[model samples]
Target: MSEEVAPHTHFQYADARHQAETALSGMWLFLASEVLFFGGLIVAWTFCRHWQPAGFDAGSRETVLWIGTVNLFLLISSSFVYSSGLAFMEAGNAKRLIQCCVATMAIGSLFLLLKFYEWHIDISEHLFPAGPFKINGADAGGARMFWSFYFVATALHAAHMIVGVGLVGWIALQARRGAFADGWLTPVEVIGLYWSFVDIVWIVLYPIIYLVGRE
Candidate 1:
């Protein structure tokens, strides 16, 4: 029950607290699973790169550094959209809240499409990690390793982008329903948490995979 709720109210204090706790606890558990998924990739990458440092370094050098940098900035800007959305939701401004979600989705779509182009260019240049590679030398194998992780991590991140678009759609629906008037903004808050978590993962990936071995 709400604190200001009347004595005759059907909802009780324990129920309200339980609901809040359950929401936060669920988010935390999901985050823990995300950590394990990415953490395992990082570990595998570390061992492989360590075993073939020269090849890994060469692969990293071949990366289009500027593109990675630009994408990082793009994603960072999208995080601001989430921040603004959270603010608008709390303030009960339905227009601004929906606007923020749409803005974030637009930016995210741009990021993913640009990423697709980047991957295409790499493939055209024979930078892929597997069979029929045209790049000369043993570094080909190493280059393949880098591309392997590149595809895996970025593809995983792109999946999150799809999920974000869905969240924005749902939020648009809620805003249309006039739900925030009741201060029922918890769903918005939870989706924001998930979106930001994905953003944070990319922030870490950007430096390690793109910038770490720069000349």
Candidate 2:
């Protein structure tokens, strides 16, 4: 494989291996904090659900299961595409790496669009907690609380996806400029780790929010 000149900033590192290790470590440290943040929310939701089983189920049943499932599929597909991009980077195939990055971004954007549509439907159905929320045949207060957690959790997750999509697009542009050449693909790998974490968080959130009461 051909080697391009390393950037001056990278000169601080002894070699590409060390630089990549440091970058990945930094990303994991950041994600650890995110884990704690989201974990708190999950714990709180678990307590609420345990306290109000009937209302939570009624609220969960009201969710559009198909949309949630589709969103999950899209997120997982994006992660796969991103992993492929990482492999392409390892093989020094910049062209294929760029393609994978763009594909991942497109998949992530579609997930966000579907999310907005789902939120619109919820708003129309009087599901927004701030509004006069309505869930027929469920304890109104408990149902309101359920929707409150639902919107807050999903909205935060969607925001993270939007950020991830933008990061992937930026990486694609950089790849087009040949910045990831010469095994200097640490940035791409770091971004992939962050994106994967976001995807995993959603995977956990989905079952709690959508599949909890579907028995």
Candidate 3:
């Protein structure tokens, strides 16, 4: 009989290792579903772009390139920070883990702030698809479609970042409470997976939203 190694190990888990594996597996399954959801959106966007190449190009040009680039770096940094925290937790350094979690949360929040600012700029430039669109040409309709996808994809990605920030905050609190001091870092690892997924989604969006048609 495998001895349960952690105080928080549930009854269903035979041991700490069992619990950690199950937790990671569950997170991966959840991420798979998320991939499909986002994948569909990407596919739909690709088809729309094919149908209205000029409009999509025009819409892409309207994006604030610097802002999107900065946000991409921020999200990538947050993922790195969170991974560092996880590494610290594995090394039995709870304090450093907490610090990393806090840092990750701060970075994620900054990304959200910048994203909102970018959206504000976009709206000011009449980029919103519903109201008065800024692009004027035969490709105006396609450009409007491009803006529509931009808003939807970016907005959805931002929403995921919001959730990720909250999760990081929670993990930080847990570390402060010594939840993973005994080396049972399952929760941290699980949340790390989620945070990484959010970062990846943004990575995919950054190019599609800001770079594709620029050349």
RMSD each, Å: 3.8, 3.3, 2.4
User: Per-residue CA lDDT of candidate 3, range 59-105, in tens?
Assistant: 89999999999999998988999999888788899999999998998
TM-score of each: 0.89, 0.93, 0.96
Candidate 2 C-alpha lDDT tens digits along 123-207: 9999887857777554777788889899999999999998999999999999999897867787898899999999999899999
Judged by whole-model lDDT over C-alpha atoms, candidate 3 comes out at 0.91
Per-residue alpha-carbon lDDT of candidate 1 for residues 61-83, written as tens digits (9 for 90 to 100): 87777777888888889889878
lDDT of each: 0.79, 0.88, 0.91
Decreasing TM-score order of the candidates = 3, 2, 1
Candidate 1 vs candidate 2, TM-score winner = 2
Q: lDDT value for candidate 2?
A: 0.88
Best by TM-score: 3
* Weakest 10 consecutive residues of candidate 3 by summed lDDT: 1-10
TM-score of 3: 0.96
Task: Score residue 12 of candidate 2 by CA lDDT.
Answer: 66
- In Å, residue 77's CA in model 3 sits off its true spot by 1.2
